[model samples]
Target: MSRSRPGNGHRGLDRVVSRRRLLTGGAAATAALAVSGGVLGADLLSGASRPASRRLVESQPAAETAAPRQRTVPTPAPTSAPTPDPRYPDGPFVPGPDTRLWGVFEPGAPSNIAALAGVERAVGNPQAIHWYQSWSGPGSELDPVRLNNVREYGALPMISWEPAHAGWGTDQPPYALARLAAGDHDDYARSWARGIRDHGGPVVIRFAHEMNHGHFAWAAGVNGNTPEQYVAAWRHVRQIFLDEGAQNASFSWSPNIAYDGTTPFDQLYPGDEHVDWIGLSGFNGGSDLPWGGWLEFGPMFLPSYEVLVGYGKPMMITEVACTENGGDKAAWIRRAFTDALPNVMPRFQVVCWFNENVLVDWRVQSSPSSADAFVETAGTWRQRTP
Candidate 1:
């Protein structure tokens, strides 16, 4: 929640850290966290989240000649069978850590990555602070030398919002989804939803995120526009920033990673009563399964987000990645936050890491032995359980 880049005195602080990365293959079609105190009973729902079975977990694979982005989708049941009734939400899930894990860069590279040691031999996980480079300029618009090459090579500028049929990168058909479901939002969805409706701050407009397992093009999603019409187009872009009075911003529905037991998180629900949090899009790549360290693989997707646990809201991973560029994949980043981040940090609240580090020629750069195991898994992943 910081700001001040207007003309460049450069104070900066509109912190909406829950990131939403990916554009080519719109990132492995799905995702995969959260926290809070009190209100936890029910003798801990069979030891907190466990229903979706047969866990496999891997990302960015399936190439032979269909490499525009792949992982086709198949890895559900880490736990989710819900239906014993009694309107759910019990005990023992203890949860903590409301999402924000960082990474994703390419704002017109120049490398001095804040000072550059050969930009860590070419992007060896430089702790990123958002750099997917959308729209480019105006208002929340940033580029001060790519925000000083993301805080001089360590990592901070977050941006990713598109969904008037995704436009800027192209997707809005059906007569621009019938003029944004009859409300008529244009100008590229009013320049990323009118800079958070007018300017309340903390921007992270994650729209049409993983649309229930399709490759890209915002799924053409329908139920007669009844995923509540994508939660009423995110409550009409959160009521056009509360009727143009404008106030920063916050809205993420992101999907993917449902480990198919015949697919049904309510056909990718955008209605947990109009979401405010719950984002899961994972990545581990390098195969051979098992990557427990990034919070011990967060119990492989906590039984498929127990069907959005009665909408108590607050969960993130908005977007994530590993590589098609291959091997040693930064030694699976400290067992994924020291052992799958305590089984998805009790339904995560903030965990964003799409750190850019390509190999091929998406602009020439190569450094994978998984970047010295992602700097030793970001120094013991926030010292275990806090």
Candidate 2:
């Protein structure tokens, strides 16, 4: 499943609309507001107004004349007051200095560790392998073969746990968050947790990823799900794993970078006790469709990064990729490692590229240039300690 812009709920629309209205109304309206002398006047005519005025001038039509740029006066810093820190201080997962690389290959049989090894040979060795499994069936059967295969390849296993039986974009999810929180799925959760415990190695479980988006059934306000219910369900699952002696298994609380307007991201958080790592899913659609554009990696992740880092948890770009369409795919890949990974996202401890060909060609080898970029970037990061 992919994190997309289709169901984003117009989050950036309000800001865009407000700015457009301010600019299109012309400087005469700005002057009128300044002369009005109230909250609007105080705000617009303040020292902070230089940037806003510059943007307004730039937004004017070609035929219309714009006001000259005004001098920018530096604003004094605000007084620092002693306030209680609101962060959840105890983040469970704390990775070492080196960021782990990971990926998901083709689905079904081709997605096994052996196939992933082939990808590693082509690109470079990733420290982890990301795969998905569903809870549609009742059996507690675990895939020891695949898990062992991953370990043998010197990589860890990262599982995207889907509670619902349906595929992505399904309107109604059969498994509701209320049901899960109420212990309807406790037996299944325990069975799965025990299966992992019996396997006896470190594993990362990313349950109901992208929950902030409306596309998932477990998402808030979907199929009778709410943010509170999502939190409840997450806590219930984590407790079950703990009770089942799944100490080797760590929990990842993941949400899509963009969320539906109705539910804030903080409301969906399951708190520090239940969460080990903070996972985020983001993608650059890269002009494959009308809604998709060739977005850089930094901008796509910054919004979520700014919020999640406050929790002081180890961060992971659990799912990320840009399409090899409309723009320079090689440059995007190059910048992701050389710029975004090392500089823009210093808090991220792991990054898993979504290498599937679904929706758009997200494979690292979509072109030779892209593949080369991956190899080169992976080489640079591999020298660090994990």
| lDDT leader | 2
For each candidate, give its TM-score against the true structure: 0.29, 0.72
Mark the regions of model 1 whose C-alpha exceeds 4 Å error after superposition: 6-57, 60-184, 190-251, 254-269, 272-336, 343-350, 353-374, 379-386
lDDT (Cα, tens digit) per residue for candidate 2, span 46-85: 2133332111001111122368667598665567944422
Q: Which candidate is the best by TM-score?
A: 2
| Ten contiguous residues minimizing lDDT sum, candidate 1 | 52-61
- 229-307, model 1: which lDDT tens digit per residue? 5545556655564454433334456675554322244655645434455666655432222332222233444555555
